[model samples]
Target: MTCKALREGGAQVLAWDDNPDTRINAQSDGVALTDLDRADWSEVRALIVSPGVPLTHPEPHRLVRLAREKNVPVIGDIELFAQAMAALPAERRPSIVGITGTNGKSTTTALIGHILKKAGRDVRVGGNIGEAILGLSPPRAKTVFVIELSSYQLDLVQTLRCDIAIWLNLTPDHLDRHGDMAGYKAAKFRIFSNQTSEDAAIVGVDDDHSAGVMTRLKASQRQSVVAVSSGRSLGHGVYALGGKVFDALGRSPRAILDLKEAVSLPGAHNAQNIAAAYAACIRLGLLPEGIADAIRSFPGLAHRLELVGTHKGVRYVNDSKATNAEATAKALASYNHIYWIAGGRKKEGGIGALAPFFPRIEKAYLIGEAADEFAATLSGTVPNEVAGTLETALDLAARDAAAGARDTPVILLSPACASFDQFRDFEHRGDMFRTLVRARIGNA
Candidate 1:
């Protein structure tokens, strides 16, 4: 999409990739046969690399080294889109709202986009949340672009200055791609690196790392920063105090809406997401009434905490997108008694960090490569068994939950690992779970 957008905007596009089966190759005007050994860069303006392209972390891709040697700038799709947006008329151009964090970025991005669309704004959501930003059609004059940016996307951005930049909360994630925690943070900070006084910066100051970043932003006297805290009352930001979303930027903090009233937005973490979205909408001139209505009507995204079906008194949740320990932790925290179906290709830390939440697991059915390690970790803490695959795990969890051993039993497929071990991606793994669940539990 980025290549297509660049081409449409009169920039000659030259796409190069080691993989010949890429969609971009079919759409591009010209394709270059690229490999680590190839060093031809005479005809290219800039090397527009994918965010998935490793630049500096886990050893930079050879192309990055080649670009550095040739003095040709290496940028990402977002950077190109930013430049394109600048070339268009100001009012005609789409307003961009960027959401970034370790967790809840997808939910936050989708929530904000849903609200704007409900309020009659043309909104297109893409970026790290699966949709390619450039592939999305140009929004109407009143359209708003809500993008969910990962640390990698933010790292490659040069001039992609968001009109409203939201920092949810930075946790230790993607360290392998960013070198270390500090390096990972540096990439996240890039979202606000180019913002000016005119732009709005919305941040969640609940976590210490994000709070530290907020402090630094304030010290620099950079831009208009709105801080949000779900933990306590923040003096100059939005907060969830006593189940109400409040804006604390004025002399007297004003109540936005009751947290319970926001139906689609649930959980303490979601409260933070709501607050940040509300703050950004308000800053962008959206009426409080419209924001409130949007929050009430928005249905949440799928495969996160999506309720698949209720069968035999057990509620099945498809949270296949919980591809990390932190994400699974949030899903686990949402439910009191969970028949957790977890395990896939293991990440660096394994499931060791989730030890604290073991008591909540009534019984964990493990699957894929990380099954043994996860079972070993939960040995004495929680009752667990290796189901070998997702199909077997689903059957075991459903049968166990149906036994009526515990009240309000919820069968949750919140794998705290990647899906590539047994499935193509998280969505495919989730679909398989849904298919198997529907086959077994739907009749019950």
Candidate 2:
């Protein structure tokens, strides 16, 4: 999409990918089949690398090394789009809201986009969430772009200053890509690295790492920072207190609406997501009443704590997007008693950090490549069985959850591992889970 957007902006675009099946290749003006070893690098203006393109961790891609050697500027799609948007007139240009964190980025981005659209604004949401940014039509006079940016995308951006910059919360994730914890945090911090005092910076002060990032941003003194908390009353930002959303910066942290009013938005993690979206909406000058209504009516995004259906008393949730341990931990925390279906191609650190939530699991049905390793980790801590595939896992989990003593029992497929082992991607895995759940539970 970035390449196509650049082409539409009247720049010559050349796209090269080792894989021929890439969607970007089809959208490009010209394709280069030449390998990094064989292609001449002197003619290119800038090399637009994918966020998935490794530049530092697990060894940099050959193309990146070639770019470095040839002195060609290596950049990502976000930077290119940023430059394109800057060339347009300020009023004609779209307002950008960039949301980043270890988790809940997609939900918050979708929520912000939903609220803006509900208030009758022209909005397009894509980037690290659903559609590619370039796939959407260019911004018009009233268009607002709600972008979900990953640390990788933020790392490549140079001039992408958002009107509203949000940092939901930071945890140890994508460490392999960023090299270390400091490097990972540094990438996330880049979301607000270029913002000035005129822009709004929303920070969630829930975890120590996020709090530390907020502290540094406060020290920088460039952008106006609004601190939100999930556990406490934030005196000058959006927060959840006594199940009601509140804007505390004004008189008395006034009540906006009760979270229960928003049926789709549940759990404490989602409350933080709601708070972030509300903060962004208020910063963008939307009325509180309108924003609250949008929050109440907006349907949640798929594959992240999504309620697929209820069979008997068991509620099946498809959270296959939780491909990392940290994300799965959040999903686990959302439910009190879960028949968890987890395991896949394991990342580093395994499920060790998820030990805190072990007691909540009624029984774990492991699947895919990481099954043995996950079962080993849960030994003595919780009961687990290796189900090998998602189908078996789902079958076992659903039956176990149905028979269990807890009311409102949950069958959660929140794999804390990547999906490459069994499926093409996370979405495919999530879709398959949802389909199987509906077929099994709906029939029963």
Candidate 3:
């Protein structure tokens, strides 16, 4: 999309990929393919690389090295979009709401866009969620671009200067791409880099890392910072407490909305997401009443605690997007008497940290490469079975859930690991789970 956009904008794009198939696809898309090794260095203006391409890591991509050696700026698609926005007339460029966090970024971005759309405003959502930012319709007046940016994209952005920027909870993720936690935190901090006092900076204060970010931004006095939290009551800013959203933006803290009736938003994690979205919308001049209405009707993101189906009294949920321990923990906290399905390409800590939540699980059906590790962690703590494949696991879990006397037995697919071991990605794994659940429940 970036290449095509650049070409459409009249910039001569020279595209290259290490993979032959990718190069072939780019060539087929009307891109002017160039051999990076042999191309004249002086002719190149800048190198636009994918977010997955490392600038500094296990090793920098050869293209990155070449670009640096030639003193050409190396950037991602987001930066290109920023440049395009800058070229447009001030009145023509759209207002941007840039959101980044280890978790809840996508949900918060979608919620903000949904609220704006419900309010009859022109809004486009992309970036690290569905479509690429460059692929979205060109910025227009009153069009608010609510984008979920990854740390990788954030690192490459130089002048995005979003009208409103949100930093949700920060957890250890993509540490391999960035050298360490400090490097990852620095990348996230870049979301607030170019903001002025006129812009709003909404920061989540639940995690120490994010709280530190809020503290630093407040001290800098570069922008008006609004602290958001799911756990505690903030002296100012917005907070979610006891299943209700409170707006303490100015004078006294007042309840804006009650989330007890919101079926899609189930857990405390989502409460944090809702709080951030509400705060951001309010900052952008949205009325609390309208924002609350939009949130109430939100269908919720697919594969993130998505309720797939119900059979008898048992519920099947596809939380396949929870490809880490922390995410799985959130899903677990929302339900009791769980028929949990977990395992895949394990992350660093495996499922060791989730030991506390094991008591809630009625039984665990493990699959994929990390099954043994997860089983060992659950040994003696929770009853578990190694059901090698997803199909087998689903069958066993479904049967067990049906036999259980629990009032609400949830068949949850919150694998605390990546899906690359037995599936293409988390989405593919999730889709498969959703399909299986539908078929089983439909047959039942």
Candidate 4:
């Protein structure tokens, strides 16, 4: 996508991929393929790399290091998009809203885009979500690009200053890619870079890392900070307390929306997402009542507490986006009498933090590499079994839930582990689960 877009934008594009198939595919698009290690430095404008390519910690990739020695700026597709926007006159440049964190970024990014598009704004949502940043339509007057940026993308972005930047809650993730929590935090905070006094910074204060970032941004006064929270009522900014969104950015706090009515926006985690989206839309001059109505109408993103189907007396939820303990915790907290199906490629700390929610699970069917380990964790505390695979896990869970006593048993696939072991990604895992559930439940 980056290569094709850059080509169409009239830049001389040279690209390479480690995968031969990918190289052949890009070559088919008229993109020139060259060995970066042997390419001439004089003719190269910049070294743009994918977010997966190592740019910093664990030592830079050879190509990245080589590019640095040759004085070529290394950047990602996002920086290119930024440069494209910058080329336009100030008034013509489209507004950009950047969102990042260990979780909730996708939901928040999509929610903001949905609200904008519903309000008739030309919104292009990409970056770490749907299409590549350059793959989206060119920026024009009133165009809003709602981007979900990963830490890796943020690391490669240098001059992409967002009109409004949102930093959601952060947790320990991609430790190998980032080195440690401190390094991870640094990458997440890069979303706030190059902002001026005119921009608005939306920071989620529910987590320590994000809260500390909010403090730093507050002290810097580089831009306006709209502190968001889901745990407690804030004296200022936006927050959700007692299941309602509160706008405390004024002299007195005012209730914005009753979250209970928003069927798709459930649980505290989603409340945080809603608060961030609400704060951002308001900053973009959206009316409060209109914003609330738009939020209520949001259909919610897939693979995050998505209700796939219902069977007999049971409901099936595919929360395959919960690829870590912190993320899974949110899903677990949102439901009860759960016939939980968990386990995949094991993550650090296991599912130990989820012990508090064990009582809510009627039974757990574990799968993939983490099955035995998770079974051991839940041995005496929670009724669990190593179902070995998602198919068996779902079959067993569904059978059990159908016979269970609960009025509405929920078979939840909120695996607190990465999906690389048994599937391509969280999306694939969720898709597989959705397909399996639909076969039995038939979309009821």
Highest-scoring model, lDDT: 4
Where model 2 places Cα greater than 4 Å from the true spot, the runs are 20-36
lDDT scores of the candidates, listed in order:
0.85, 0.87, 0.90, 0.91
Best by TM-score: 3
lDDT of candidate 3 over 218-333, digit per residue (tens): 89999989999988999999898988889998889999888886789899999999999999998788888999999999989898999988888888999999988988999999
- Residue by residue across 238-270, what tens digits does model 4's lDDT show? 999998999998899999999897798788999
Q: Alpha-carbon error at 379 in model 3, in Å?
A: 0.8
The C-alpha stretches of model 4 lying farther than 4 A from their native spots are none
| Model 1, residue 401: C-alpha shift (Å) | 0.8
Query: Which model, 1 or 2, shows the larger lDDT?
Result: 2
The true-versus-predicted C-alpha distance at residue 268 of model 2, in Å, is 1.3
Candidate 1: residue 330 Cα off by (Å): 0.9
If ranked by lDDT, best first, what sequence of candidates would result?
4, 3, 2, 1
RMSD of 1: 2.3
Could you report the Cα RMSD, in angstroms, for every candidate shown? Answer: 2.3, 2.1, 1.0, 1.3
- Regions of model 1 farther than 4 Å from truth: 23-40
